[model samples]
Target: MSSSDLAAVVVTVCVVVALVALIAVLTQAFALMREFRRKLEDFDSKVGPALSQLADTAEMAQAEIGRLRDLLNIAQKVAGLAESAGAATARVAATPVDKVRSAISVLRGAQTGGTGQRGKAEEEGRETGSGGESTAAGSESRGR
Candidate 1:
């Protein structure tokens, strides 16, 4: 063959080889893009429901927290009422005890036939003489 025709043939073969390589690279890029699209679709299908469920769970948790807060408020009110009731009960109970003590002192004065001073003096005498014995024993020994 002529030198010019041989050079042309060589250039044409190189161009064809470069085109084939380019086509191969483009085909691989297209396949990679399709694979990436499929993976993105799969991720959306799986994660979409999970995100929705997470939102629902958060809402439920908030509701439960609100319920708990309400319960705590009710418990605080109940505790306050209980404390008030206990204080009232203590006052009511103490009044009766004080009244009974006063009545006993009055009865002791009547028994002594004077003010309650004689009764107290007599009790002190009994305590000093009886060596820690009960008041009932000392009264029995004294014959009332």
Candidate 2:
């Protein structure tokens, strides 16, 4: 064969080899892409429900927090009412207690003859040298 023809044939063989390698590489790339698409679909099918469930859980937690807050508000109001009731009870009780104490003091003063001086019986007892015990014994002997 001629030298120019031989060089042309060699170039043509190398081009054919390169084309075959490119085809093989393209085929492998297409297969890899198909596997990647299938795995992505599987991941979506598995993770989609989990994502939805997570969203539902978050909503439920928010609802529970709101409920707890409402309960706390009610408890605070109840505590305030209880404190008010306690103060009212104290005020209501104090007036009656003070009135009763004053009435008892007035009764005591009446029994004591309503004067700063001693009663007549106490004055007579002090005028006599003996205490009122001797007078009570003499009265008891007379009753027997």
Candidate 3:
């Protein structure tokens, strides 16, 4: 063949080889992209429900925390009221009952005979003897 024709043939063959290589590389890249997209879809299908369930559980926990916070507030209010009431009771109880109880005990002691009734007859006899002396003196004067 002529040198010019041989050169043209070599150029055409080079262009054809480059085109085949480009096609092959593009096909491999397309396959890799397709596989990546398929794995992404599969992950979405498999993991989406679990992520949704996790969100639901978090919401439930938040609601429960709010309820517990409300309960704590109520308990704190009750505790405060009880503390005030207890303080008022302590103040009111600190006085007169003790005085009245001591007074009552003193009165009872007098009634029960301070030394347990041992001096009752002696004390009574002293009062009766003094009266009897006056009467006897008056009777002797009247009789004379």
How do the predictions measure up, each by TM-score? 0.59, 0.62, 0.60
Per-residue C-alpha lDDT of model 1 across residues 19-61, encoded as one tens digit per residue: 9999999999999999999999999999999999999999999
Candidate whose lDDT is highest:
1
Residue 137 local lDDT, model 1: 54
**Model 1 CA lDDT for position 50:** 100
- The worst-scoring run of ten residues by lDDT in candidate 1 lies at 131-140
Candidate 2 off by > 4 Å = 1-7, 98-144
TM-score for candidate 2, please give it: 0.62
RMSD from true fold, candidate 3: 10.7
Instruction: List candidate 3 stretches off by more than 4 Å.
Output: 1-7, 97-144
Q: What is the C-alpha lDDT of each candidate?
A: 0.86, 0.84, 0.82
Which lDDT tens digits does candidate 2 get at residues 28-127?
9999999999999999999999999999999999999999999999999999999999999999999999999999999776755533233444457768
Predicted candidate 3 versus true structure: per-residue lDDT over 28-55, tens digit per residue? 9999999999999999998999999999
